[model samples]
Target: MSENNNPPEEKKRPEGITNSYRERLKALKQARQYSVAGDIPKAVERYSTYLYALASYFGVTEDKLSPSFFDTEKEISELLLISHAYWDLSKAYDRSPNLHKESIRCLDQFVKFTNGFKYQHINAQMLKKFIKRKQAHNMKAFQNAYTKIQVDSKGCFIASYSYGPEHTVTNDLRKFKQAIVNYRLGFRFVEVYYNTSPAIINFLEKSGIFGCLLNKVFIRPTLLLISKSARHL
Candidate 1:
């Protein structure tokens, strides 16, 4: 007889609804409503409660979560935004600035943790914008202590998805850097009013050399302290 040497398969993880998940979902919906209605404190309360539910129901620590029910990428992304969302809501509290900071930190961590992320629809571009925002926000903090300003470094293309997957690399870091530099100047935005429309995003995504990352938010180079090279910007 042939030697039998198959190892036992590990037990599959259970998928059952706990009372806490139901309560958390209920509260998440409430939080969504409150957020839309301009009642931020209630929204914050609901979100905090939802997190509590998450911690308790999952039988893990505050940061640990059930893999079956939710994705780690999405959960962490939302959590990072929580502080920023709170900051935007309650002007009286240290919510906005601090939370914005926290959000940036969380986002940065997430970027390091995962290979890539698609925020709403935009992938690499969203984090790039977030980095710009954080640079501006933190610059203000640094302004009090120093004279000269500072900005974050340029985008490093880990990979690109320009029409399926392109193993070929395009060194457009200069163009992206120019985009930020131009933004720091007084260049007006092209207006992203149809943010609710994914079709528009899809259209743009399909029609472009750069795909979805080429939205107007990132295009239209900054006006010159001195004019930059046309190709780079």
Candidate 2:
């Protein structure tokens, strides 16, 4: 008298994900060796080559395949190589002509799921940093919000706006402790400050202040790019 029944669930995600990361670590080490052995091209090539292969544990990629999991989202969230592995796979998708847009989509999903806030919490250091960034935001926004809007001889309404903050402390040690976390995990933070988007890009270009921004950034273990507007003297 047997019935169709499944066995009780068991924990599985951590071990596989850990093992996969370890294997990738080994591959990266080999890539370095190749570089040291004077095979720079192969070394660079090996760095992110097998990223998609590591996605088996998650229900990612073309296949909806996932390892037997007690809890899916939490397990993926626990992956230690969350930064590098996902970045590599995202690039893999991007370089593939068939998967270019898909790659961005995949990366967007990964970014949403594992932002710095999830990886790092509001510890004492971060709280102080948050306060500082908020202060900078307020000062700059007020400065811009109050500037007079002028018009030239032409029908054009003469005005200017900025990416704001107009400056980031770069590693700011305090303000970007979260960004440092991501850097320590081996991914670079490459967004413009105060919100850099296509619209912002167009605005900056139209305002003709994009060049000065190149000088204000602090690039280091992490990078910070900020911009603000000032009427020409």
The best candidate in terms of TM-score: 1
**Alpha-carbon runs more than 4 Å astray in model 2:** 1-22, 28-80, 116-233
lDDT of 1 by residue, 64-108 (tens): 433343454536554434333332322212246756554443333
After superposition on all C-alphas, the RMSD of every candidate to the true structure, in Å, is 11.9, 20.1
All candidates' lDDT scores?
0.40, 0.35
Report how far off residue 174 is in candidate 1 (Å): 11
Task: Candidate 1: list runs displaced more than 4 Å.
Answer: 1-17, 35-39, 57-60, 63-116, 120-159, 163-201, 204-233
Clashing pairs in 1: 87-95, 87-96, 182-222
Model 1, position 202, has a per-residue lDDT of 56
TM-score of each: 0.38, 0.27
